[model samples]
Target: MTPVPTAPLVRWYRTSLAGHPDGLNFRRLWVGDTFSQFGTQVGLIVLPLLAVSVLGADEFEMGLLATFETLAFLVIGLPAGAWVDRMRKREVLVVADLVRGLALLTLPAAWLLETLTFPLVLVVAAVVGVATVFFDVAYQSYLPSLVPSERISEGNAKLQVSQSVAQIAGPGLGGVLVRALGAPLVVLLDALSYFASVLFLLRIRHREGPIRRSGRRLHSEIGEGLAFVFREPLLRRIVATTALGNLAGSVTNSMLVLYAIRDLGIGETGLGLALSVGAVGGLAGALLAEPLLKRVGEGRTIALALLPALPMYVLVPLAEGHPGQAAVTMIATSMAITGVGVVVYNVAQVSFRQRLCPRPLLGRMNASVRFVVWGTMPVGAFLGGVIGSRFGVLTALWVGVAGQALAVLPVLLSPLVRMRDLPRGLDQHA
Candidate 1:
C-alpha cells in the first residue's frame, strides 16, 4: 500500500496560527466564547443546585431535567439548522446567547420573589435548552467561515481547549460561588457572561453571507440537510460512531451524581475538584491534538483516541476506598479520557465535515448530525435510570463501559480506520 502523505508538524503549527489572516477577529471570537463559557459553567452548577435546594427535587427530577435539556437537540436541531442557514450565523449565536441569559436570569428572579417552583424550574431548563440548541448549531456552522479549511482541526482544537478550560475553572468556581452567594444568585454570573458574549459579537464587523434558501420550504430544506448527511460515506460513519458513543456516555452521566454522592460519599466540593482535575487532561489533549494528528493522520488519530478512553469509564466505579482517594482516581482517569477523547474526536470530525460540506449547507449539516448524535441522550438517561433502579449502580456502570467500548465497532468496521487524511475536494459519491 502507498503511504499516505501527512502535513509536517512545523507546517501544521504555522498553518494553525496564521491560517486565519483576520487574527484579531479570531481572537475576539475566542475570547467571547471563553467568557460566555465561564457563565455556562456557573449555570451548570447553579441549575442543579437550584433543583436540589430550592425546588427540593429528587433523582427522578434531575434525570428529567437532563432529559428535557438534551431533548431540545432532537426537537429543534434540524429546524434550527435550516433556520440558521437562512440567516447570519453570528447573529443567530448572539440572539441565542441573549435568550439563554434571559432564561437563566428568570430563575434567580423567581427565587428572589419567593415564587420559585419545580414546574417553573422545569420551564427554565426547557427554555434554556432550546436556546442552546440554536446557539450550538449556529456556532458550529460559523467556524468554517472564520478560518481556512486546512486549519479547521486546529481551530476546533483551540475552541475545545477554551471549553475545557472553562470546564476546569467554571465548575470549581461555581461550587464556591454557590456556597457563598447561594445557587439563585450564581445564575446572575452566567447571565453576565451572555452579555459579555453579546458585546464581543457586536464588535465583530465581518459580514457572513446568507444561505441560498431560494424557494425551498422549511420542511424540504430540513429534509435536504438530512439527506446530505446520510448520503455521505464519511459523514454516515461519523454520525454512527458519535451517536453510539454519546448514548453510552449519557447512561453514565445520568447516574454520575448519584454514584458520587452515595457510593463514593463525596460532597459537592469534592465532586467539583474531581471534575476540575479531569479538565487538565482535556487541556493537554487539545494542545497536543494537532501534533498527534499530523504524525498519525486524522483517521488513525481518531481511532486511537476513541478506543482507549473506554477503559477509563470503568475506573470511576472502581474507586472504593476513602472519598478523597476515590475522587482523585475518578478525576485522573476522567481527565485523561475526556481531554484527549473529546479534542481528538472533535478536531477530526469537525474538520472532516467542513471539508465535505458546502458553505450554504453547513448549518443544516451540523444540526442534522447533532440531532442524531444528541437525540440519544434522553433515551440513554431514561434507560440508565431504569437500570439503576433495577440492577443497581455497579451493574449500570458496567453497562456504560461496555456500551462505550462497543462504540469502537463502527470505526473498526468502516473505511475510516484504513484511511489517513480526509479525501481532498468533494467526491459526490463520498
Candidate 2:
C-alpha cells in the first residue's frame, strides 16, 4: 500500500477543545466508538446468557463460543492490517460496522424462527470477530490522523472514557433487558447500536486522500509489520506484556459467566450487577489515565498499573468459598481493580506506540501488536474450557490468576522501569 501523507500526524495545534477542527472529528470517532463498545458490552453479557441459560451449553461449548469470537484475530490479523492500510480508514470503519450489525441480526432471526443453535451462535461470533479485526486495526491507525501528536495521550484517554462508561452501564442494561425481553430479543439492541455507530461515522467530515496502490506482496507487507513490532525494544517489551496479560485474562473470562451462574449461584441479574459494579473502576481508571501519565510518566504508569490489580484476580477463585451475595461482591471488587489497572496501562502503552510509529506504518504496526496480544486469547479460552471441564471452573480461574500475576514481569524487568518519560516520536527513538 502507498503510504498516506504524514503532515496531519505531525500537525501542531494551540487547542483541541470541542469546537476546534481536530476536536470535532475526534468527537465523531469517539461517539461512534462509544456506541459500538456499549453494544459489545451488552453482547458480552447476553451472548453467554443465550448459550448457557437458553441453549444449555456446557463449559466446553462456552469456551468454544469465546474461542470463535476471537479466532479471527489469529487467523486474519496480519493480512487485515495490510488491507486496512491499503484502503480509506473511514470507509473501512463504516463497512466493518455494517457487517457486524447485519451479522448480529441473524441471531435474533434464528431465535424467532426457533432455529437458534450453538453452531449458529458460533458462526455469528466468528463473523463479528472478522469485522472487528479490520475495525480495530483501522481505528488505532486512524486516530493519529485526527489529533495532534503531542495530545495523542489525551485523545486516547478521552476514548477510553467512552469505553469505560459503556462498560459500566451496558451489562446492567443488558441484564434488565434480558429479563424483560428474552436473550434473543436483547441482541437486537446490539445490532441497532451498530447501526447507530454507522450514522455517527457518516457525519465525520475528515477525509483521507485516495490511497495510492502498491505492488507489494501481501506476505511481505505483513512481515514488515511483524518485524517493526518485534525489532523495537520498547515495542517488543510492550507486546510481550500485553500478549501475556490478554492470554491470562481470556482464560479467566472464558468460564466466568458459567461459574457465576452455576457454582456461585448468581442469577443473570446478579452476574450482570457484579460486572457492572466492577466496571466502575474502568471509569475511574480512564479518568485517572492522563493524570497518571503526567504525574508518574508513561513508563512508570505502564510498569506499575497492573501490579495491584492482577494480584487481585486471586480474589475471583476465592469467591467460590463465599455465599452468593458475598461471592458477587468479591468478584465485583476484583474486576473493579483489574479494570483500573488495565485502562491506565492501555492508555500509556497505546499512546506510546501511536507516537512512536511513522504514519505510513501505523496500520501495520498496530495490527502486528494486536496479532500477538489478541492472538493468544483463543488459545487461552480453549485451555480454560478444557481445564474447567476436567478439573473445575475454580481451578481454571486460579490458573488464569497465576498467569496474570506473571504477565507484568516482562515490563518490570525491562529498562522501562528506569525511565521517567518515553520518547515523544519515532524520530526521538531513531
The lDDT of each candidate is 0.77, 0.89
Top lDDT: which candidate number?
2
Q: What would the per-residue lDDT of candidate 1 be over residues 71-93, giving only the tens digit for each residue?
A: 78878888989988888888888
lDDT of 2 by residue, 251-349 (tens): 999999899888898888888888999999999999999889998989988888888896679889999868989998999999999999999999999
lDDT for 216 (candidate 1): 68
Q: For each candidate, how many residue pairs have backbone atoms clashing (under 3 Å)?
A: 2, 0
Clash-forming residue pairs, model 1: 278-335, 282-339
Off by over 4 Å in 1: 1-21, 425-430
TM-score for all models, in order of appearance: 0.91, 0.95
